[model samples]
Target: MESKEEHYSHDHIMESIRNLSENDAKTFLNLIYALLRDNTLPSEQLVSHVLSVYEKKIPRVVKTRQNK
Candidate 1:
């Protein structure tokens, strides 16, 4: 279970995000995307890992090391 302080922290962060102007939100997301793009890992493998962890299910078509 999440602690009260942790919940409040997430809530505060979300509230701050919600208060951003539309343009600011877009720019923030774009910057995050740029950082992700600059990583050494392949994008598809990163996506597969994220889905497997968060969704608790294997991706239908994960990339193999041999494919690289």
Candidate 2:
């Protein structure tokens, strides 16, 4: 059986992908398409890669105060 730790890691990876830049996300999707032609692709890897890209670009800042 799959462990909860595995599940959580998978979920976190997907969340990172959701945070990816639009262009990066689209490019990864296209890569998936090209790579999966007549074959099975590992979605988790693709999603994780997308998220890794996001992690590089997304700042950790939660908020900024300017005119507030």
Candidate 3:
């Protein structure tokens, strides 16, 4: 049995992904494609979920007015 501490949580995985260089990212994506090809992952729904999570994390910009 694996303890929670032994598991790579979503945040840890995301942080690792964020640290990858472009070439590494390409290799990572190729592995994902292979997994998809072998039916190891869900198709478009996974992409949609990732995109939704990414979009929600973007910080909104607010404008401020200055008084003279």
Candidate 4:
């Protein structure tokens, strides 16, 4: 079980990410990728790990916007 503080921290991080501009979000994601790459984790392993963690979260329909 997650502690209240941990839950709040997670929510805050997600909210912050959601509010980022598209370019900033892309840059943030690149930074995350660079950090993982620097740690010598293989891209395949990262993808597998992320998918497993995401699967454990609540399932929902992810809607993608069509770029005009």
lDDT of 1 by residue, 13-64 (tens): 4555555557755766675565567666688876754433222211111112
Candidate 4 contains a number of clashing pairs equal to 0
Candidate 4 ranges beyond 4 A from true positions? 1-8, 40-68
Off by over 4 Å in 1: 1-8, 41-68
TM-score of 1: 0.46
lDDT of model 4, residue 53: 31
lDDT tens digits, residue span 1-68, model 2: 43323323455555656556687667766765665563454888766654544343222211111112
Task: Judging by TM-score against the true structure, name the best candidate.
Answer: 1
When 2 and 3 are scored with TM-score, the better candidate is 3
Model 4 global lDDT (CA atoms, 0 to 1): 0.45
CA shift at 17, candidate 1, in angstroms? 0.9
Candidate 1 weakest lDDT stretch, 10 residues: 57-66
Candidate 4 per-residue lDDT, tens place, 1-68, comes to: 43322322455445544555677656556755666666566878877555433332211111122121
For each candidate, the alpha-carbon lDDT, in order, equals: 0.44, 0.47, 0.45, 0.45
After best superposition, candidate 3 residue 66: deviation in angstroms? Answer: 44
Runs of candidate 3 exceeding 4 Å displacement: 1-5, 40-68
* Clashing residue pairs, backbone N/CA/C < 3 A, model 2: none
Model 3 vs truth, CA RMSD: 13.9
Provide TM-scores for the models.
Answer: 0.46, 0.41, 0.43, 0.42
What's the distance in Å from true for residue 8, model 2?
8.0
